[model samples]
Target: MDPRSEELAALNALGMLESDEKRVLDGSSLVDRELRDLNAELELVAAELGRLVVPVEPPADMKRRIRAKIRSRGGSKLRSISPLALIAGVGWAAAVALALASIWLWRERASLNQQFNSLREAIAPVTQPTAEKEEKEKPPARNLEEELKKLRGDFESQKTALNTEIEALRKREADANAKVAQLVQEAQAQKERDAAMKLHVATLQSEIWEYRRSVMTIVWDASKDQGALMLDKMPRVESGRDYQLWIIDPQKPDPVSGGVLAVDDKGTAKTTFKSTEDVGDAVKFIVSVEKKGGVPKKEGEVVLKEP
Candidate 1:
């Protein structure tokens, strides 16, 4: 049986398969005996889980919500963008990196034009021009400027989408954590290993830059032994310098490197980083400005950290 069929079977058992996925699984299960048996077993497991876990009651306003949704169905639906898409498209959606690059390029081109005009003025004094260089470049410059404007708009839209996704992810994580906490307490003795896993989330704001606001957030997934760092309104690092993250474990004496950051000019970055050593229940997280690639140990100026 195909592995895809196996997954669809489990989702079907839980009544979570979409209409299209249900069709695929139904067709596959007809021909795949192993997949059929797997589905049957999973359906039993789902039934048992349903019996063991208390079901949550629907909201009192569910009917009102349904009616509102029905009325809103006439309007075009908005697509839910994933934050991970920003990570993958890192540069363009990457704090609208292409927008920044394009702006930089536009400025450089404009500077070159100014220099060309100055040189032309210097030459025209010595020689009478038979033909003038018509302003043929003006149209291209205008088009480029228009493109930059569109990119800026796109950047704002992507930023808003990222913010919404981050909030939704946090809410889902909170719900899952609450549920897991209850289950861990109830079955700690039976499954101490699983119960030991944990997650940490912290938000830090800086006051050093009095003019602008800066925010940093870290989400530590203890089970995965990794963490993600998100920054906004941060100050751009100086030339030949980069921002680095440090994970401080109480068991260790020094902070471990959690990878160098690539922040855009506007002081925004999002990256997943890990330490050289195990981050067993991190005590704290620190951000600092380091040389180009980062150092083995934190020998840079500490800029932000958790209280």
Candidate 2:
């Protein structure tokens, strides 16, 4: 019999009561026949509304704009807002807007019902005959059936327009979701590329070697097991010979063959190579002139050597 019980009953009718609250209300058995009837009527109205209403999606940039606004405010205000809280606020705002639209629609429907009743009242007296003389003199009464048919056609047209709008909104929502997924994939790929570059940069070692008329510069990264060689002003080799690079690791008796190299007519050559064998503790690098195809051993004259 408490006043709060009636308020709780309304919330239950709206399907918004928590499980524990519903259990308590059910156990109390204080809700009278009048309250139960009100709850049932409200539930029926809600069911009818669910059928009439279409699902609506919030604007694609709604969250983005809200976050941007928060960022622009700056300082303690921005720090105070958490992402989850911001998202929840946006959802609450959307719900409020949707509720307002439904209320407006219901009001319009009620107004139309009132107009229909007035129209029926205006036409009722015509059906009940006054004096036969007055009836004949009043001229042919307007066709009420034709008027009702026109109203029904207008209602159908409005319904079709609303359905088309709903379909368009659904398609836009799908497209927005696809675009967000593509952006996420691209971001992940970029992050991987950045990590590789950083690792290569971190492991890099460079040394300059000078001998007689030629100077050779070497840049290598042990993590990649690869390096680049640059020779300046070195005399061209014999017709059947080519330059080869060797990576010497103290752990191995034989130096690893780094690829063969060819220099341009200007006596300047630059080429990159990957060691065939592990060069993790490489102590020295040597460039040798050998037969067109390089040899596994140091079987050629040393053109350059690095400490």
Candidate 3:
């Protein structure tokens, strides 16, 4: 028998090469080397097919009936497979879509996590205290209590020093106020001295005016016996400088001065005088250089005298 036919008979006997395998055999067009290799492999397959006893031949009519049954089963099986295949294909497509969505979500989550970390870093300085504060909170490696005590002592010392300086400043301000008061008193005294000097000057001027008015009323006439009542020419003087006359009595201890008189541009002084005593021979008139106020004593050379 052909090894392929023998192997098919063995597979039929073992119930492994079922109606589907027979249908495959019926549709195949394998030949030559391919057929020979298939037949050799079939022999080996047949050797392992030992579950049932082999029959020499299936009846020709039975083969026909079996082929008809296989066809019918194939059609029904194709119908059965259609819904499951459709469901499996849809399940696979949904699984692939879910996997892609999950991957996209994972990537986006990673990106968001990176952004969150960046924002956290950016806001850290504003949200947290400075490094100096952290160092203050952290205890020193050694002598923590001692260092804190030292700092407290230093702070107290600085506070005391500031208070002392403030007190010294207050004292300096008091000293300045005392000096200002003394200066004010001195200024008041100086103003009083100036006022007193001005009053004295006004009194002296009044006295000089009263003395001159009294002297101008003293009148004396030149006697005809006294060299024909001679009048002489007067000397010239500079601006604001003038000559004055004095009256002296040989009988009195001090001379009585007369009113001040200045010569006009023509160098002439005319005066009318009166005397209490009738005799004018005892009084003599003397001319001397003087300032506008008249001198208390005779100054410069005597310019003229009447005796």
Candidate whose TM-score is highest: 1
Tell me the tens digit of each residue's lDDT in model 1 across 132-186: 4335435656765676677678767867777676667666667767888998887
Could you estimate the TM-score for every candidate? 0.37, 0.33, 0.23
Write the candidate numbers in order of decreasing TM-score.
Answer: 1, 2, 3
Which of the two candidates, 1 or 3, achieves a greater lDDT against the reference?
1
Candidate 1, 270: how far from true, in Å? 1.2
The clash count for each model shown is 0, 0, 2
The top-ranked prediction according to lDDT is 1
Candidate 3 lDDT by residue in tens digits, 1-307 = 3344445445644457655444333222121234335655665776675656675786779988988999978976766554335455545655665566557656755665676556556766786857875564444323444544665576567556655655665566677678889999999998776444321000000123212211111223334111101112344655666666565656655445554565666444545433222323556656566777666566645555431
In candidate 3, residue 278 scores what lDDT? 32
Summing lDDT over every window of 10 consecutive residues in candidate 3, give the lowest-scoring window: 198-207
Worst 10 residues of 2 by lDDT: 197-206
lDDT of 3: 0.49
Candidate 3 stretches greater than 4 Å from native: 1-142, 199-307
Candidate 2 TM-score over all chains jointly:
0.33
Worst 10 residues of 1 by lDDT: 78-87
**Global lDDT of each candidate:** 0.71, 0.63, 0.49
